[model samples]
Target: MKKIVLATSLLLLTVCSAQAQIASAYAGRLQSVLDSVGKRFHIKGLSAAVYRPGEGMWTGAYGESYSGVPITTDMYFPIGSNTKTYTSCIMLKLQEAGTLSLDDTIGKWLQNIPNVSGQITIRQMLNHTSGLFSYTNDPGFFTALNSDYTKVWQPEDMLQFIGAPDFAPGTSWEYSNTNYLLAGLIIKKIFNEPYDVTVRRMILDPQGFTNTIIYPAEKRGTIPHGWTVMTTNGPLEDMMVSANYDNTAFLSMATSAGAIVATAEDVAKFWVALMNGKIINSNSLAEMKQFVSINANNGYGLGLFRMRPVNGHVVYGHGGTCFGYLNENMVDSTNGITIAVLTNQDSIDNNQIFNWVVTALHKNTLQMAPLSIAGNEKADDIKIYPNPASNYVDVNLGTANNAKFELIDMTGRNIINTTVDGNYVRVSLSDITPGLYLARLSNTEKGILKTTKLQVVH
Candidate 1:
């Protein structure tokens, strides 16, 4: 008995050692992918962080914050429109506390200059279905912005550029920063304080996000300078010194739309906490995720964007672009994975970098643990229906007992896996984004059985 116990303990230790080595190997591969992408894009600097359910968190930074400052995980970057997510979260929290209702109109909350009516609801504003014109689209707006980079802009001044509605309220979808500016106004009116004060008390302080700030004018010079090109192919220019990097002019007007700055790690942590239901109630979160289809594969939720990538997994988050910064934060809710990518230069292809990093991580996961069953059965006996599924798919394992199944993406990443209780097993595909997937079944005794393609549409 003593010899048997000693052998079992040794086996467990060996398994733990092997797992640690695999994790270390994957971390090295992830860093390599970041380095390659940063060099290819000629990004001034790039910072990213990832959090997996079981693996905890990992962060990487490449290139320079400025000419000589090496980018670090703790350095702040302007998250741009990602501030919409925070603004929307604040609204949902207010609704949960009975402070306000999503059905409330802008006219009810604050006085407006033009086209204000009861038809426009807070829900429509949050989801970009308000049909309001985007102030940023005006050519004269840019002309003025460039002419006087130091001129402070009030919310009403920005509103003057919104000449007309894009379409009837709630009749179409259009992204408009004006909607969020109004949302900020409503927040201030309700709390009887500045928008930033409420944001800090409700979100930053509660989350212990020490690195996240509202971009105060006094500390503008303390942050890393934003870089952008002056002409089509000109050399990089320092936007801060040029009076363009979150200057008082832009910050005063962009309050709720684009004026938040945070480190990559803090961004990832915020999403993780949000996903785990630590920040908002489950019902509020559900309301936030009520996605409105923007296109065949993209959707807009309250403050978040629901995207179905080529890999078929649904990602929830937002992307931001300011004068010289581009950033994105994505959360794979199904797998509890969060990724935050931030760059100091707007020229970088942020989408490519995000996709490459996720792909690398998923590929490493598959390599570390390849899914396989025991036996060697033929590959023609299993059936999956409906062939094109929307919500759920049923798998029929004929004449095979105790089978295991997996739903894989085109990239060969195992997205979902489970065991078959009897002849038929029902798998939930509701959380998955609309795309193509592969269903595979194998018996414990039969090794390999069958594979079939699946199409999901909603």
Candidate 2:
């Protein structure tokens, strides 16, 4: 019996090694996907990573961080609201240790902040149900933030910008940085140390996430120069180019709400580890996954959001933005594959680019071309007949079962969403307006079967 068990263990290790080796072979193509998407979007710098459970991880970077310097896989980017995941995890861990209860009202640990009541529960804060006003939305806060780029803001100082509560606590849901700001203060108060120190002790150090750190408070190494639009209709300006544009004040103000700097690879690994019971226990994870329905296709859990990119495929993750950076991390529920995409420029939609990267990574066959402008290249598994169709279009789902079809416009709006079976399916375009649309086929088993550009004509 012992010999059989040993042999089985050896066999499993061999299979995992082979799978990782196969995944590594796609490195060049993955790199191409980043390069193509980054250039198309005019991103100053971009970094992306993919983590498969049995297969090893892959990371890629593109474009220049500065005029002459290039973005590398090792460079850090502020993972804006993604920091909320860490903050939420800390609160859950504290509950597990009997340090605090989620049901406890904020009034117990904190008191007397204008517009914020003590009646808000810890769970409400973690899940953005507190109805607290988002301090960042206050025009005064922006004025102060712009007034002094070098000034490090205390959590309370930020709270002063809060005008009034959006609604009564637990009455409705609204995304507010103020909720997390108070949560960070509570963590600091409970641990008798800085909030980031608790984060380091609880999550970062245990996972060997050496590259990730709370920014401004911790010295950050040289990172890709991040860019942002300074005015409403302004061009992208490098945040690192001058002290006036420095990210220090913004990051400091972000605090626990959105102030962690780390590589795309580390961000991807963090998600996979959290979901697999490394950061928290199984029960805690289950609690985290208890989602509140936000819409037909999306839901919000504790710190994470359910992303139903297509029919039947759900990924749990978060997206974030800092002064000059936009980042997104998603882990596939079905396959346990994690993907993180980071870009320096804040103007473009990182989700559209992330969806393209996901489709590129899960190609059933290697014969497909690199990811390009939607609708130009066809995948080997699926084929869309006729270049332009006025009333109907036929899709051939080669070797794909239980697939769902989705048509999205250029603005990322869903035009048609439905499920289909068999090898051949016809979609009606009679209602669709004349223009370009991206037709995507996906299922639970395979993340993205195919994404092609389709043109609708009258």
Candidate 3:
């Protein structure tokens, strides 16, 4: 018995070590890109974090937060358009309180809400489907952005350039600050509170996200500015420019659009909470996850962008960009991974690197975990009726004794899991949301499971 106990301890220790090694392996794999960037470019530093559901989590930071100070998991960075996700989340929280509806028109709140000859819903604003023209494209705006760069921008001033509708609202997916800016306004009118307060109360406090700052600079302190490379000879020339890196200040201009600062860890925490229904109720989250076709090329769901190809599992994410820092992050809810990639200098092809980082992380999950049941567990004949199972589905296991069953989301997180026997299993989905999920069947060893993606539509 003593020998057996010792062996059991050793086995548990081995398992723990292996899990840590897997987490470290993922970090090392992603950190390699940051390592390469340091050698290849004048990218002063890069930081990335990856979170796996019910597994290992780590935030890998390379180089400096500034010039010499080392960036840590706690240190903040300017998280550009990633702020849009925050803003979108805030909108959902307001929806939860019964103060507003996605269908509410902008005209209902702001008397001056631009009626660009087509009807646009509040939902479109959050999803970037609103046909409003982007003010950033206006030549005059850059002139403003370059001059007093941190000058407080007014909505009327922004609207002057944002004039006219780009397309009839909801006609397509075109990202515009105008959509989010109005989203802020709608929140303000309904909540009857300052935008910052609404953001803090609705999003930050609820998610235990203390580090997230909106309108971070009040001309309060020396803030990091977005530095861009003007030219690239054999030596790259960094244009020492300042665009308020303080979420407190820049976020004011970005309001509900783009601009917020947070550590990689906090970003991951926000995503994990949101995906798992910690920040918002499951019902609103379900609504937010609903796919709205953006165009032939893509689709948008609430505040998130759902990437759909004529292919594999769709991923949801948002990318961000500012001056000095070019950032991108993705959360595969189905797979339970969150990746945040950042670079301090824009001298490199940041876009390519960000895309590569996410792909590598995703590929790593696929490679590391060979998640398949063996022994020809074909269930072609084992029927699960009502493809989008509403409430109940008659699952015919058909002579498969002691079979293990599970209801899994796209990311492979098991939701409703159990083991049962006999010829048939009556699966009740009253608890599952109306979205795609697989009904998996398996046995203890040399197992087989059927992957039936079910949707519950009430």
Candidate 4:
């Protein structure tokens, strides 16, 4: 009996150790994904965090905050549009308390000028089924915004810019910032206080989210500079100074639509807490997940986006894009894994990277090869004949047989996929466009074994 007990104890210990290692490995792979995204997007900085149910959190930060300042895990980012999620949470909490209902019309809450805006239901506003014209899409609004970025905008002022409803309320779906702006107005009317005050009290303070801030007034100390590129191939310019704007004005204007600033870890924690039913009841969460098709390809829930990537993996989250920042906070409801990616740059599609992160985390066993010096050495062995191939490229993998090669473009799209049978593989780049690409070599079982930069020149 004693011998049997000792053997069982040893087996249990080994199993626990293996589990810990697996968790660590997942964390490593997540970091690699973040690094790759930052490089590909040409972002000034990228900060991300991943949280597993029982395992602790893991954070990864890459690139510079400024010209020389390296980004840290604690840096703050403007979570544009993600503020809508928080606002929706507040509305749900109010519903739970019987103070309000989702079916309530905007006319019942606030004395609005526009009949169409007032007739829009709260549910329609939250889910973006409201037909209100997006104020952000207005040419006059952009004209004013570009002229004076520091101009303080009141919610009432924004209403003037919204010309008319696209259609009747709830008839169709469109992503309108005006809907969220009105929602913010309703919150203020209900609580008899500023929307930011209510958010801080109900969400930020209770959750102990120290890094999250609803920018009340413009002060730029801890926050990293926001950046924007003129074109896909253009250099990044500092919007803070170049645009001659204070973030406070932009924050005030964005309010409940796109104003929340938070670090990656805090965003992940917020999503995890919400998913675990710590914020609202399970019923509210269910309502939030009750998705309606925004288009044939995409779906929208209450302040949340339901994404079905090419891999067919479903994730619920929000993507935020302000003047100079783009962010994504996603959750895998099945496994309770949360991923938050925050960047201080604009115009890049972060969904592809976020989807990859979700797919990798969902797999039973994360099949990733070493992405360090060892992997680089293996990549060095496989040589491409021309440093910059014009039409065709020859990859000499030497003894690396049965390896699969994938040529991925800068947009995170796989442009080519072929298999290597023997020592050498010839690839025709005649049809391929002249640009940058990543050549990834891997096997069926080991996942990505090696990756190298490949340049195509016309």
Candidate 5:
């Protein structure tokens, strides 16, 4: 028994060593991506993280908070609409625990709003299918918001500005802040506690996400300076340093809809863990992924966005934009690679920065060594050798397992496909063209086991 434990410990150490090696290899590339993007946009501050399952994570920051105050990994930024994901997860967890049902109508919790109908389901609200009017769309709300920048608005107060519903409940789809605002209220109604408290107790504490906070209600002292233009079509300025500038009005109104303040690393960690079924159960995750098509390339899931493809990899995450913060986070569906990009300047295009970061990270993934794990198994158990091969490459799956091995080109075309029944399988590269290809090994039952880049040489 002791020998078995020792062997497992050694294997774990090797896995960690490999992960560290890959992380170190990609560190400079990630930093370069962040710096280049920040410089191009003249961003005041930016931070990012890329998490690769079975490999490791790389976090970096570029530019300054105001002037000489450099942005660090620990600095917090309000992750705008990305907060909706947390709110949705909390609701799902409650449903899983038999406390509530997604089909429960909003009328059960909230009422007496302007045009919101009690018939809107919690699931509809989560997926933005409720067609509820967004309070932020009303210019009058902004006037009142700017009237007292420090004033804390309650969830009920913000509902007064909600206009008529765009469409009836579950008829169509539209993004509405009011949907999540009400969702938060329902959470509060169910627990009789502040929604943020429930968020912390249910999600943050269990995940060890100490760097993240539900904004306004929970405060962090080391938040970096957030920048945005005072008026539309105006020059950008530091909102934090400006006199009489307080984020209370904006964040308080954002509430569970968009007020989570967190570091980029924490954001990435949350996405990776959530997708890996650490935050929610498999059934809940499946429900979250039931996307309603938003467009040809994008869709809306429960508080999640099926974003446009980033370098041929379809990712799932949400983007957030607040007064002076813009953030985009994604976890690759194919590889489970998670990337998060956050900028203190709100005016810049988050997708552009996110795309650039993804491109760089994608390149880094291809360059890293081949190492991956089967379901809940140590990655050291599997090994691929003679990577740059002329005729063939050996795939040792560690133990007798039913799996399929395939070599796919950079264009996503499969070149070689075969099944493995034993501990080892030799993939034929003799007929394949000499170029870079992705080697994938997937279990018949458990899905994709491991994927790594292979260089097929003549």
Candidate 6:
């Protein structure tokens, strides 16, 4: 406990010193605001951790991990939907290994998955375009969630919603747990192993992430964490949620789906690992990043969520939920900011905190990409094919070489950074989340600047 407290205090000092160029009051108030958040939310024993770039690491616990005992920074939490992004990563890793194809139809891997069309590609499932039924919406989902919800759920057991199709694949997008469940099944079939094992082998083990978990049903008695009690009318109760359960129940999410646990720090590390080409083969991981539409979380990609704006830069991550708990986590890998929050509360302040933390972090983040076109060169030449692409994009520089190209979105952060050595440079824009982005190219030596639109519609 002394070591942990010392480490946390050092992180605070680091953040303060690193941000000295900015201001101390800014840092102090930011920390204060987090505590205020705990108080405002009636947050009991809540924990918040951040990994700021070029500064001190910050992690502190308030309230308790539960009402009875003290919660520390080292303790683990479910991290909810944050697990989905990892699930998506495993699928991409499999594709890179030639065990699966992003374009593979659902019927190709799982049994009795009624194919609305033979086009329900793995890409669509990860991007939530498969239009499958969201198992969370099933009343039976909640009914089972409360009583003996710890039973081990095989992939097929979770896929019982295959009786009808919600919409034609890729016609419209809807978040469906069935998609992830199928993804998990596909992983199992491809790797001849359990989904949890495959994910750890691919993402967790490679990155050395130790705090997250995928609850297994058989280990019910050992579960950690709590839930906030709330009625449909929303009353605050000093109750810990179902922290203990059979960890195996998490398997129901399938290998390619949403069953994993992690700390805010691990979430940050994984985002950076994925961005820095440390998780899987660079080419395949890039494919996983291609963004997709998820109306609920603003937008989605292969398996990520484009959460919000930070220093006018886009942030990426995912939020999650299970029976009695709500979880939300986010990361802006480019700028090195990560936020993870776990709650036993029946509901959470995902939107408010997302904005608050982003605002605080944005104020301290350096080199916030400026989205200015007033004086910049207007680019009319050069074209990049497959704008909303799933896997890759082809850039035609039109005789221009040795230039830098940037794929910038509304937040002004360039999602893709590449240098042109030939007339055409094919960049992998997948693996990242999906959304609208602009392609900017500049030859500072030649004093030439060109901008174009690039979309990855995978």
**Residue 235 lDDT in candidate 2:** 52
**Residue 275's lDDT in candidate 1:** 66
TM-score of each: 0.73, 0.74, 0.72, 0.71, 0.79, 0.70
lDDT by residue for model 1 (255-349), tens: 78888888887888888878656688767887888888899878898988887773556678888877667787777643446778887666544
Give lDDT tens digits, candidate 2, residues 11-108: 00000111122245566666666666565545577777876544357777777676667777888988899999999999999999999998999999
Please provide, for model 6 over 1-458, each residue's C-alpha lDDT reduced to its tens digit, 9 standing for 90 to 100.
00000001100111111123223544465556555555555554444555543333455454554445654555555666666677787777777778778888876876555533446788898888987777655666545544554566666665544546688887887777777777777777877987778776777666787665565621222234554434454344433443344334543543245566555556656765675456766576556656665554357777777755555556776766653344565665333455565544434445544554435444544433332222323334466776567688777766556666667766534567777886678888667677777776655343224555566666
- Candidate 1: deviation at residue 58, Å? 1.0
User: For residues 1-458, what per-residue lDDT tens digits would candidate 4 score against the true structure?
Assistant: 00000000000000011112225766666666656545544556777776654444677777765665677777788888889999999999999999999999888987756635667789999998888888777777767666666676776777777777798887888888988988888888889888878998999899898889887542333677776654445555666766654576767778889888888888988998886567888679878877778766568889988765524445678888777777887775333457787776664555544554334444422233333322223656777668588888887875566676777665334577778887678899999999988776655333345566789998
- Lowest summed lDDT across 10 adjacent residues in model 4 is found at 1-10
Model 1, position 329: C-alpha lDDT score = 72
lDDT of 6: 0.57
Off by over 4 Å in 3: 1-30, 37-44, 65-67, 113-118, 154-157, 217-225, 231-251, 295-297, 308-312, 347-350, 369-458
lDDT of each: 0.70, 0.73, 0.61, 0.70, 0.76, 0.57
Superposition TM-score, candidate 1 onto the true structure:
0.73
**Residue 157, model 6, lDDT:** 60
lDDT assessment of candidate 1: 0.70
Candidate 5 ranges beyond 4 A from true positions = 1-22, 231-234, 371-449, 452-458
Candidate 6 versus truth, CA RMSD in Å, comes to: 10.1
lDDT of 2: 0.73
Please list the Cα RMSD from the true structure of every candidate, rounded to 1 decimal place.
13.1, 14.5, 11.8, 18.6, 11.6, 10.1
List pairs with backbone clashes in candidate 2.
375-453
Q: Judge candidate 1 at residue 127 and give its lDDT.
A: 94
Off by over 4 Å in 4: 1-26, 115-117, 217-221, 230-234, 309-312, 350-458
Candidate No. with top TM-score = 5
